[model samples]
Target: MHYCQSCETPVAMEPRNGHAVCPECGRADDVAAPGPLFVVTGASGSGKTAVLAGLARRLQGRCVTFDADLLMDAAGALSGSRPIDWPAFRDAWLAVAHGVAQSGMPTVLLGPFIPTHLQELPARRWIGDIHFIVLDCPDELRRARINARPPWRSRDIEEQVEFGQWLRRNIADRVDTSSELQKTPRRPSPHGSTAI
Candidate 1:
């Protein structure tokens, strides 16, 4: 939250054009042009986390990359005692991405986000168009990878495989991570003004 200098009102800062202005006072804060959001989505064990690690390094100063899992701990806060409100959780990540865009860096979020998880959100207005890239691998490989993980992760292989197929059918961009496992993360599919 930003404070309006003249009126001392708390401002929920969101970029307009290329700047964020205090609605109370109309005093503008210089914010960089908003950048499009890039979402690298996949089912569990589809190499999203591994890919994010590489992207954070490779994208260094060019753009910012993040794992949506970083906010998992705060899910309780967002949802209270009820089951996690997934849409609210997604909104938080979108807000973070929009804030980063104000600093002139495009953001790539790594997670299990489908288009519906983002496209209709209120926060979507603060960022540019969203582009989704699904990371994919053979079903056998995906199962083996999830099973190899520590016991805490869900090992429901069939469910994940089904989800992966849905993503492939609905999203046009896909990175066959099994083929690229030895390589660094594949570059994300391009979108409206983002350099990634």
Candidate 2:
């Protein structure tokens, strides 16, 4: 599930001369075997970055752990007031995760993503089951966490609070991040299936 950066269109798995070329922009890249995609999502300051750091340490040799935001620079320009194509950004990440999974290691991606963002994308077929784990904490605590971040990382407090509330209400698989992240239980097996 690749997205053509030039055309801003979803790229499907079709080969031309044994190479996967974007029908929309003629962009080319290699396609790899598919594997499950696990998304660790939450609002800003929900400890996603922290949790990813810990999870990466634990799952280092077992699976691939990545911060989805690392691709922000490649996804699109963020200097102006132009509206970002969030879905396209998400699809691009999915494609990357799929590529990484070809090594037989499932990818655990951390970002402000929800199941709705990736479940229905054409790239969804590139992976096996998609699992979503929402990280949440109380609104007041979340505000404090966000407030403590560096000025460059600051976000709209109200918006993040609302987004956190919405995730708790909609997602069943959640990790209460108000407490120490180390206290969080062991994650699902990273081999192929995620119990959560």
Write down the TM-score of every candidate: 0.79, 0.73
What are the clashing pairs of model 1? none
Error of model 2, residue 187, in angstroms: 24
Kindly list the per-residue Cα lDDT of model 1 for residues 37-131, writing each as its tens digit: 99999997688876766789999998899888777767766667898778888888888987898788899998899888788887777778899
Off by over 4 Å in 2: 1-32, 78-82, 181-196
Write one digit per residue (lDDT tens) for candidate 2, span 97-131. Answer: 77777677898988888787888776666777788
- CA displacement after TM-score superposition, residue 56 of candidate 1 (Å): 0.9
Clash counts for all predictions: 0, 0
Please give the lDDT score for candidate 2.
0.73
User: Who wins the TM-score comparison?
Assistant: 1
